[model samples]
Target: MSEKKNTNHGPQKGGPMGGFGAPVEKAKDFKGTIKKLLSYFKPNLVKVILVFVMAICSTIFSIAGPKIMGKATTKLYEGVYGKIALAKLNTQKVSLEKIASMSKTPNPKVSGGLAAIKAGIAKVISETGGKIDFTYIGHILLMVIGLYLVSALFTFVQQYVMAGIAQNIVYDMREDLSTKLNKLPLKYYDSKTHGEILSRVTNDMDNISTTLQQSLTQLVSSVVTILGVIIMMLTISPILTLVAIVTLPICGIATSGFAKKSQKYFAGQQKAIGELNGHVEEIYTGHNIVRVFGREQESIEKFEKINDELYEVGWKAQFISGIVMPVMNFINNVGYVVICVVGGMFVIKKKIEIGDIQAFIQYSKQFTMPIVQTANIANILQSTVASAERVFELLEEVEEIAEDKQPKVIELPKGEVKFEHVKFGYKENVTLIEDMNLEAKPGQTVAIVGPTGAGKTTLVNLLMRFYEINDGRITVDGVDTREMTRADLRGMFGMVLQDTWLFNGTIRDNIAYGRDNATEEDIINAAKAAHADHFIRTLPEGYDTILNEEASNISQGQKQLLTIARAILANPRILILDEATSSVDTRTEIFIQKAMGNLMKGRTSFVIAHRLSTIRDADVILVMRNGSVIEQGNHDELMKKNGFYADLYNSQFSDGEDVG
Candidate 1:
């Protein structure tokens, strides 16, 4: 069945809405997945440490800014206030001197008060010269600016180093995924949709990359900022620091509540996106079929349904998560009011300076942001961990069975093959083929004919070891196929299936894909032999014409011919053709048959055909029914029997069928 038909279009089970909805994709083992993810950082440990140091330095420098700026404020205030005090004190000094001079018998109280007044006035005049001191404030401003510049410099360095670390780790992850994909068994591919597998490699990996590049460093900086701000606030006024902290529990409660509500919606959104992507990919690839069947409206309707669901969940997810910041800001603002009132009282009591009050308020504001950032990062980390777990799950999947430690070598393959007592099934306890025995001598053309799902393609799959048999062995040149490496075993055969596969590339490159290091002359010769050379010369670019992603530029018959050319270039000792000429017209089929005949001249060949007359000259013909061969003989012998083969052959021609 097509993968699209097999896809589950509905939401997944075990969601918050019971068993009928899409559940959030969470890490089954958060700690374990995080540990595995961290392993990727080992190679860049030094860089990670440096990033940490830089983050701390940057945050510390930034945290010190408001406190240092407070000094400038204090210096300016002192100058302005001192000048005003000096003027007031001069008047008082004159009055006190006049009173002292009038009281010839100096009163002790008057004498002490007058002397103290004169001392204060002199001190104020000396400090400010009865004017504001701009020089002192200028120095303080420069110092603050210098600290801010250094902070910015540290931030830039940390970000640059962190981006490199993130990319390197993602690069290694991508390489590992690529390698793992190649090593995985064919059954794995058969069981998964192309979109599902691609999502893990592409979407999941991208999520990890984004989180690492942005969120990871932000998490570190947010933490340091929070700690550093706390310390600075405490230094300014411990009472105000306590007031700022009292609001944290409320922020935490609000964030946790919103995150819990939005997380499931986020998961639903992701699931819906996957479904939408799968639907689009499937419909696009099979658009021609859909148009022919007139199902465009149906496809659009299905798309709308999925899209609507995505929109619903997306808004809910975004709305719930979005409110967190505003709500947090509101709570922090209330806390800000409380801190201001308390700091003002302390200032009036002379317990803290005016500059200290200003610094404390700045620190209080700074304190709330990192807490919010940390909460947001926590949520992002949850999603990131979920993505990481998916990647790790793929890496940990069971791979193909290991090759033989000391595999036997095939010096020169002659294409002799045998399947003895072969019992097999795609699943256990459901045998598709049982007690099958077959052999083909070197250079013999053996044809297999059968109804759909009659084990015809299954036979070829077994020969190539795309699947392993349940009980028995297949041998090539009298050596058990299992004894040889899969590469060596598969390398001996060339295949051209009913469904052609051609990658996007030039005609020359596509044909050359059949054999490594194939010369240009070899590619053209193979094309000529498959009768593809004529079509190649007819194109505007000839062999240089680039096929699009779907290879839709060429006719179906042309694609088949190109595949045949590729098989020809391979020049394998064994050839397997499963309805290789099914897509072509009679004339093209005849030409392909001729090319195939020449290609199969000295190689053992297995031809699987639906057309009864196509394999009339086979050395041996095997007719399969329901997983077993019901008839085995050549054309003349099978016709004499008037059994299944004869009946099938006669039916094809009985209704005035156009026999080519």
Candidate 2:
């Protein structure tokens, strides 16, 4: 049980870094898992292509904004400088005119040359303006705004398309998983825990969904943004672009070192958390047993120990991962300073405009984020692929053997069961039941009595074909069980096991679960026949009462009665009652015994009971020991033979001991 629990409830694969502290679980076959995951998108290939196109368009539009906005800044700067130059030139023109007018018989040639130069300067000043070009700036601003709005629209479309594709693929995946679970053999479930299978279906599937919906789109946009920003930066100034690119290697080394260090702590934290959860689940579910054994304090101490370990590893993991962003930012800041200094030098040397420097700085800042995002996304993909691989593993599990294609149909099952030379085992080398043979006529009540693990229930399980026989044949109504479809063969019988299963619903619904299209009257009649109607009517809501998840609202005996009621409604040709009355009081047992007698009339019944007294009236008693029947006869005949059956019966009656 512990092994199964650990297999199922162990540390789950990590998701997108919850604060970059969760460990990323890598897939054993990364390329294979990726290929399989992509196959799921084949049906949505067109939509996927559309999403990529939209993402690229959106990113390209966004990348153009900084460069376009810089044009407006350039217009403003050129206007301001031109106005200053023009004003200075106007002052010089006035001084030149005054000198020419106040010549006092100056030379004519010199005066003519001065007049011509003054006229040319006046014409140049008039052709330009001493005020800023607000019109051009307004046009540039409008164009930038339009580009941003279009970018946002494209982003919305991209996300909308991608979301649909993700959900549809996940939907198909979940359907396939559900179907596969049903087709899996019982041995698979026997070797696994309910939690483990559920974790694969719920947690692992959710991880895949999250990655497809969010990370896939983000990865595309990040890559496009990186490429687009690089191009824009180079166009602005290749020298500044080179300066920004040089810092990347430093940032990469730092990030990789921190990620490796934090990964160890993150993995430790995850393990500790799983341990703590396991301890808490075990304690809470068995709290009564713990208290009865006086181990409450010990359990508490164990819980505290696990909790402390979790805290230690959790803090270290978070602290280490937390420093990565700050360190990367510092490196980026250094690169930004270098780019700005080079850009300023270019502007002063008249090699580049001030507005171009602004655009390049913006491009440089944009460049680093996508690179970081791509790295983070790469980590997220590792975890996502691991989840996908786990799910695929379950889907690829061995299913039950296929039913006969032309299966024989039993139109009216008579329930004459026979086992001939039957051999079986849970494992190949360890035989539990070997060469076992049994037979029951159409309407006989065959009682199977034995000690625990004596193959009493195994006999019934073989008769029902829950597990296939290793050798020989089992027949129902003179037809080989294997020749009939599993559904058709099992449909002829009704079972009430020791473990009563009741889902969360009304009592009426649970009883009616035995048959399709059962009317209210049919349900009430079955309940009355099982002797459960009286107690059920005494409840506050009677048949309308709702059962909780575990059906804990009802007593154990009441649960058994409900199950009997369900079997009674089924009214199958063969009835199996495996310790059905074990949980009830003696008085209730008598009621149940009478009900079983009535239900068994004209039907073949197999009763597996530990109490020898309960099956004395059965037509035949088969005493099983060591997976084989040691004796078989009626109660009186067995007593007369004075064999193993006789000793088992005498011991139970004389000492009031359950020989079963």
Candidate 3:
């Protein structure tokens, strides 16, 4: 066996919620993860369907709006420039198609242009008697304005309904994730950091929320606009429609290339950011240690390195994604030029009207925009799917072993506990505690002491059922602990650890947390028992003094006192005190020890202490080494035996060796 030391190795690995900076590991089952994410949409299916429908309606009106407005432009052009100009032409040998062709040529129109115009005027006079339509122009203008207004209203309705659906889905996700966190095993969290878990819950959920709110609608609108614009353009002129479609293949190739590069950079950028944030967290959490050691320069140097890496990846990711716009814009301009030239030829031939040519140009612009927005939305969805992967990972984490189907409750008994033939280890193929046996009768105080990692806390963890034993059985009042529900077994004990925990709430609330529905009187009495009431009363708000987020306003000793008060309020049949007075001053230590003694009266207790003196008065002392009990006796009895316990005890006083 390896020699044991009084040290903790710290926590293990775990999972996340999504944000921009999560590491770039591909989830094990990508398709399965997406399927799980989609399952959440089941409850909101109706609302989601409504959102898509509204989106389609909104996009259709917006697409048609540009074409409708072209009517006004055509009317003004024909009334002021075309009809009156045509009235002056004479019908000899002229045609508008031939005139348009000659306008683009060098010098062919010099002699025939005047005679051709006279011929066109003669033709127009025969058709309309040299009159121009003015009343029809005004009516078309009103209709165009009304189309724009309706389009605006549909878009508003679509967005409003989508907002509610997206937010509600996000709410359900957070709620479900919270429940999953509670159900996860202790070791799962032991493996990961707080920031990682928070990212999966907050950042990832936000990604999903934003995607549902915006991307879904954008996706629907992009499709509707693309199709609607194609049909509109075809009606005006098939040649122009073909010109517009020709650029799509070029855009597609460019888009595919940029997307691959951008996604690669995006993943790298997120990973670098995660590493940088981790460095910041580590530096800040150990800021005091850093100051004491004067390692500020080294810390700063480390930060700079990480920051430089982040800048490299972040710049590349952004640059790659941004290139998509300029590339697509170039392709669209190429198509636009072709369409305008072809449409002009059709107009002169009288194969299509000037109004139709204007409408087709507007349709072309509207169509190109949806393609751009859709491509951008594709990138957004990639990041969102990354977020969903995180949420899925968290939801899929392994939970604690199932509770007994026919469960027993810890009821109607004295506080007697027993551990028999227990064997366990944190990792498989290495048993730290093997075939161990122990007992604590009703009202007896059992103190377990050992070097760190010798399974001192591990024993308490087994008793609390935070971890399961590899073999044998633990019992409370002669009933096997495994048979009893975990909730019931845990409910019988009240524990106080070395580190105190207090939330952002009043002093009274922190104390009252030990018991459900505890009244003010119950809180006050528990505080008095733990000797925390006097200082609490001295505060500005007495028991109502609010603790800040970190509870840093109070001293360490005061926080310990509050935790003791919380335990006192619980008043459980079994008590476990773990170095409860380790960090306090000697005077506060005395008060804590006294409160602990009072608290232990008539209750079965287990004390895990580093200070041997604190456990000297324990009913039984179980000395542990490498996960086995090497000595078992009261203080005086162990002193007489003069073995391992003697060295441990004498080390504390003989030469002032820090046995603790």
Would you list the C-alpha lDDT of every candidate in the order shown? 0.86, 0.86, 0.79
Backbone clashes in model 1, listed as residue pairs: none
Where is the poorest 10-residue window by lDDT in model 1?
13-22
lDDT of 2 by residue, 1-660 (tens): 131133432224332334464566789999998999999999999999999999999999999999998888877887787677767666766766687687887767756766775665566456435568899889999999999999999999999999899999999999999999988877788898787889899888888888899998899999999989988988888888888998999988887887788788887877787788778878888889999999988888988998899889888888887788888889999999998888899999989888899998898889988887797788788878888999999999988878998999999988899989999998989998888888999999999988889998878777777677899999998899999988898899999999999999999999999999999999999999989999999999999999999999999999999999999999999999999998888888888999999999999999998788889889988889989988888888999999988887898878976433
TM-score for all models, in order of appearance: 0.88, 0.92, 0.85
Candidate numbers sorted by TM-score from highest down: 2, 1, 3
Candidate 2 Cα misplacement greater than 4 A, ranges: 1-22, 88-129, 654-660
Q: For residue 270, give model 3's deviation from the true position in Å.
A: 4.1
Best by TM-score: 2
Off-target runs (Cα >4 Å) in candidate 1 are: 1-24, 91-117, 123-135, 253-321, 655-660
The C-alpha local distance difference test score for the whole of candidate 3 amounts to 0.79
The residue-level lDDT of candidate 2 at 652 comes to 80
Position 553, candidate 1: lDDT = 94
